[model samples]
Target: MNTLKWIKRILMALLLIIFLLLMAGFVFERISRSIAEKIKPDGQFAEVENHKMHYLQQGKGGPTVVFETAFDPAGHLQWYHIQQNLPKSYTTFSYDRSGILWSERGANPKTGEKMAEELHTLLEKSKAPKPYILVGHSFGGMLTRFFVQKYPKDVAGVILVDSQYPADEKYLSPQLYKMVNQGLPGGFLKFANTFGAARLMFKNMFPENNQYQYQNSVMPALLYKSADATLEEQDHMKSVKTEAAAINTFGSVPLYVITAGDKTKYDSFIKDQKIKNEMLGAWDKMQKDLLNLSTDSKQIIAEKSGHYINQDQPEVIEKAVNDMVEKVSVQ
Candidate 1:
């Protein structure tokens, strides 16, 4: 009888300890979120499909340049330096998709077509003049393509900054795809964020790249919606690809494909010599294929950079946009 009572007491003690730890985590998470909200960048909000969408705009007048970002917590910040460097004679805009950064999650399904539509509505409601010169990086490249297909009249030209291609699944090894698709389960990530685990990981992740505004703007988005949105997009990549494949030719849309020339970057992600070689070959083929989409297309290789060319070679991006703007002016 005494032994049984001791076991029961120990179990109860353990449960109480866990309860206290969870409560502490919840409190910490709430405090961190409040702090992040206080320091976020100054940006305007517009209602799209009954949800608040955040955007940053600069400069004035035509032709408006729209920035579409990757599946990153930094949102529009990915294009910050390039956007800031552009001449004020042309207007520029960058935005967080719904459930990203400061934007509220909308009711529509998280598919590229729906997102393309939401972007159109957001542009119209915000009074950002068009036709826009769409600049897309990584996953944003997919969204930009969808936008062009759905609303070709809204876009004057396209600049793909190391964009994601529709046939990526065909080229990427199963191991790499599996690693990307299942890196971390979203439900677990959401649970971790709620209990402050995500915040701790985020702090460790960005320890070396400290900037006041970057931390202020990115941390909240990382804690709030980055995981869920990322997972949803990955889950629906098949549909996104299908939609992307629909529009084979842009019919002289003035496309500019900026490819990262550093093939060695894949060395870190892929260990197998054979698979890595295959991926590199496939990557080069796809980039070349993107050039054929528009008759007036040109390609620029950012030889010094890796995947994030905007970060490594902002000058290249700035020149690309200015060149596109100049081309549009003559048309």
Candidate 2:
């Protein structure tokens, strides 16, 4: 009888502890969300269809430069530094795709084609001028290509920064490929973010030397949105190849393919040296192929940079955009 009573008491204590923890998590989540809201959002929203798309615009006059983000959840924030430094004569804009950052969740099947179409509408509604220069980084490169293929006359030039090729997966080993393509379960991320656990985990993930507080403040909001968007895009990866096939050539539109020079950095992620070399070679070949999209295209190597050339060597990207603008002006 005493043993049974003791067991009941212990179970009750455990339950009470869990209930308190849950309450604490709820309070923490509210606090974290309040902090996130205090941080200023980068841009305003343009009504596209029934949803709102967030975008930041700066400068005026010259050919408008539209910046597309990588697979990052933070969206427009990725181009904050570069956009700020752009020449005042040239207008620059950066925007978050639907289901990212401040943008409302979009309709189902968020494929590349759908994304590009939405962007077209958003630009038109926002009154951004025509004959625009499009710049895409990483996965965004594919979207930019689709945009040009769909609306060739609207675009003045293309800049691909460490962009993803349709054949990019072929270079990776089966394990590495799976790891890269597979995303975390969206529901789990949502749950963590709702209770502020995701924010806590991310806060610890960054090193002490990393002083980027902007990212930390925005991570909680990005946690679920980024994961869901990434998974949705991964589901439609096959469509990218179809889009690439349709655009056989970019005509005379000036194209710039910026390849990262530091392939060895990926060695840490890939243990085997030979496989790393093979992956680097495949990436280089694929980037070269991107140049074939236009007769006037050229490839520049960001000598000291890795995948995030804008972060590592902002000068390279800035110079490339400036050069493209000058070239477009002459034509």
lDDT of each: 0.80, 0.79
Tens digit of lDDT per residue, candidate 2, span 230-266? 5566557667656655666788889999999996768
TM-score of 2: 0.86
Clashes in model 2: which pairs? none
Model 2 misses residue 149 by how many Å?
1.2
Per-residue error (Å), model 2, residue 24: 3.2
| TM-score for each model | 0.87, 0.86
Top candidate on TM-score is 1
Top of the candidates by lDDT: 1
Clashes of each: 0, 0
User: Each prediction's Cα RMSD?
Assistant: 3.2, 3.4
Give the alpha carbon lDDT tens digit for every residue of 196-287 in model 1: 87767665333244433564446544555665776677677778878887767877899999999987878777788887788778778888
